[model samples]
Target chain A: MSERSPQRISRSALPYPYRADGLVFDVQAVLLDGEERVDVNVSRANRRWAFPTDDWERCRIVGTVELPSSVVDAVYPESERDSPPGSLYVTIRCRETIYRDRWMVQSETVEPKTYEVELELQRDGFRGEVELKPYLTRGAADQSTDDGSYASSTHARLASARPWTMLVDGEADADGETGLDVRVESFSTSPRLPKDGLYYLDMGDPSDPLIVVNGEHNRVVGVLQSEGSVGAEARMRDVVFDQIQYGVWSQLILHAGVAVDSTGRPQYDWQSTVLRIFARDLYGIDDIHAASRRLKRDLKDPTTVPEVMQRIDRVLQRYLRQREQLINLMEEGLRI
Target chain B: MSSGDVDTDDGRLADNTGTPLRTLTSEGRRLVDPAFLRGERTYADEVGQYVDEHTSDVHVELQGLRADLQAVVDSYDQYDSTIDAAAAPAVHRRLDISRRIAADPGVWHYLAVVEFPEFVRYRWEFNTETAMREKFLGAGTDIYSNALHRLWWIAELTHDGDDYSLTEEVLQKQTLANKIFDRWFARYRPAAVACCAKLVDESTEVAEEVTLRLNRVFSTRQLEGMDEAELGRLIQDLVTDIQNQGTTD
Candidate 1:
């Protein structure tokens, strides 16, 4: 047979570079002492993440998690088993070459650590549990070990210190899929603890640093950084901002371990509770204050309670009317 | 054609050539033609007029209602305006009904719909199609639609699939929608809905503080590293906590 040109083969099959699975962690923290604590709970049964590839570089992997009906009932007692909590699944596929060159670097080059955690209600009767584990990356298998590079320094610190773990039992299944079962704890040092409270978890590198923290209340459940070089202070600030306005700050306030006083009274300070709840419920405290100020200003006078109430009603009525008029105009304009 | 000249007595406009140029009224204007000068009246204009006319009436009614509310507030011995505001609507409605039980409170409910003043109207430009679309989708339209959407969205955004007690709290708050809902939703999206519900569940003081801080942070932080999904989750978490705290007592 005449020599024939070989057909060009495709280098990659997937659209995205990596895949990630997020698990819902039902984390409970119990403060054993001032400096030590224990956390325990079930991890998010379902995982969700995205992978990258060509054309549409990001691909999503999604799958349903079938927890034992009993577990479902325990976690969501009022929820019917017929309809389990639906989990979002995402996967990203990318070219093998892109995966080799880029995804590898993004996943690896960070250290792992463990932490001790605890929780106590300022009062009695409201108590909770805390759990700690190491957060690890599975995709990093082979890479040059150069400590001079920032990534390398952060990685080295992480590998050597093996600090506190933020993620627990994150691994891939037989099908080359990553699975994580983490207890969604109510507390994280990064978000709740003050900046000074963050110890090692806030050190080294400008992009990816090796920072670790041992909770003073729950020393065992420390938070560790496995990726990014930015200092823990700046990063913690960002995390704090994110958590308070748009992240887990709200969740913690709503579901935090509660306690009661010896006199059968709730021990949580009302003001603190209010602050926590506001941080959790409102995106930021500033917005609420602005609204309150606006409301107060609109009220004009506050001589008596009845007058104040009438003013409030008037304000609400006015507000609703303004909105209605706007909507009506929009509808009319659309028709035109 | 000649008969047209005689038809002039029949009240029709005719040209010098004796043929009708076009129909005209005694006022020398087109009788049947469309007038391009007719101006459009907006809801804002209507509402502004309504407010001006009823200002005194509203003030009087408010005065009476305030007296009744003061009595309730005295009984509770609570002085916070936020708390008093929450109790105002139900209290006002009750007092109004007590005056006229023979007539159901349903008719009075429509009074809540008011006109938009001109100054406020100028604050927003309704010139674009996108803006128009958003206006319709927002909770400011018809009472039934707005109320229904507000209630349902609050429930959807705030509820953790099962817990809706906070949603109830949100519905109870007068400022929840006006002072907090729109701005939060406009700036934050679906997350704001949940946040508003949480704010209601949480102590109003806390909610107020958080909203204030959030606004400040949003203005200062560039937030380049964070993605929208992450932000949504964060907001949801905050709202969830608020709900949890609301039930703690």
Candidate 2:
């Protein structure tokens, strides 16, 4: 069997030539749709961010990256600049494995001090993360023919910014399966925690948020795995578990804050542990760094209370109207 | 040029999200079903459901390639290897989409599993369940599988701008393409052209040996920095060596 040799990808691992000197190539994805810019609170700390496929539909990713002189030299030696052997270009590349799409969104053939990146990715057909890379392609004179050699050998990525990955999935409704899956499995079959545990995160692939429903918990599994049959018990069980799930939001907020970039985009780096953990308050909270800072409290100080936990309590109170549901249950009992 | 049905069972689709060029994502249901792979049926409406999603809307139009492929499948009564080679240029001609979109597996996945599955079944004949799945959904980045995708890509790699002479030669005659797919170096268009030019007339057995010899040569010498003439000379040297050695062997 022939090994898969994708012509698009360079075969060799490109080591940064100036790693010792700490020369960095950075590409920041500044969403360009809102008046000044988009204020979507996404975690980009891990150099990765996820948007509901539609959230990015109209948004253009704009960022600037400087091309160090040394890197330019790698593409063109001093002696050859007067009459260059090949045309050099800088381009923004978006790569998605799930759908297997890799193509240059933007390209600039003229060598400049910096390369500006811009493009809006289509939300259609693609359901996974798309890696954005800015690399230099030198179409050398020798291989510059009508033949497809340039597509194969023209790219010699001299030096570019660390790649930025754009994650596209709206894991909104747990029942709705698109970007991720919520599986029901028998955890009781294992030698672990309480045999009745309802749900646990299988963090094996941090890139994906897979919520494993413990099949041992009949009530939890039955409710979660059901299509449209929700009884009073299922509704009440959903309300109770909604608290556990809602309480998870505050932590995601904090993590999003700690891992954000200078532009305030959260750099969760691989810690998007629970993607479905969102709430009414989660949306429209533009400045996560500021919000997280206000909600933060030094745990080392014995006198200080983790203010985030308190905030979470308020969030939990409004979760599926827990207080309202509890009161209704109590009143029904008294009437009975 | 016609639009695909946009009404979706899932909310994944939107008003103005992407191009008409579709892809069958690995998410949710698969286009190829189990029974279909087992060759138990010719077609299955329950084969699969694809979400109505797309790359961003762009002004990309295709040249009725699917209809062309369907015609090819119609010509063949049963499994014949020549069908792919025969249909390749038609795929290459009509769907000369942006190399970027072409690189995407989803578009090909959509075609093979959704649009032209009959063609896929006719081409490979679902020899085995494992092989059938690969023909439908397997071969990540490998150009050897996915019946329709393999054909289109093979044509793309071998075709020049507005010229598919090389592409036709590779697919139609079964001359030099498959044997060269093994070497990573042949992905370079110049090298592929040079190698094909040198080995097209050789018999299958002789061509196979020469290709192996060429693969060894590429191991040391870089195809990236080298030009077409140099590649041609290098391949010519190997062919000459083979011709000279014919007397002894």
Question: Candidate 2, which segments miss by more than 4 Å at Cα?
Answer: A1-180, A185-336, B1-19, B25-28, B42-49, B58-63, B74-77, B173-175, B209-219
Report per-candidate DockQ.
0.01, 0.04
Q: How good is the docking of model 1, as DockQ? A: 0.01
TM-score of chain A of 1: 0.17
TM-score of each: 0.19, 0.48
Q: Give per-residue CA lDDT, model 2, range A116-219, as digits (tens).
A: 55556554434445655544444443443324322223334443345666655533233412243556778868543236666665432222335566777676
Against the unseen true structure, what C-alpha lDDT does each candidate score?
0.28, 0.51
Candidate 1 local lDDT, A122-191, one digit each (tens): 2111111111111112222123432222111111111111112221112213241112112223235345
Cα RMSD of predicted structure 1: 31.2
Instruction: Give the 10-residue window scoring lowest on summed lDDT in candidate 1 chain B.
Output: B30-39
**Model 2, range B85-149, lDDT digits (tens) per residue?**
67888876766565445656666666666656667777786567657776766433456666766
lDDT score, candidate 1, position B153: 36
**Candidate whose DockQ is highest:** 2
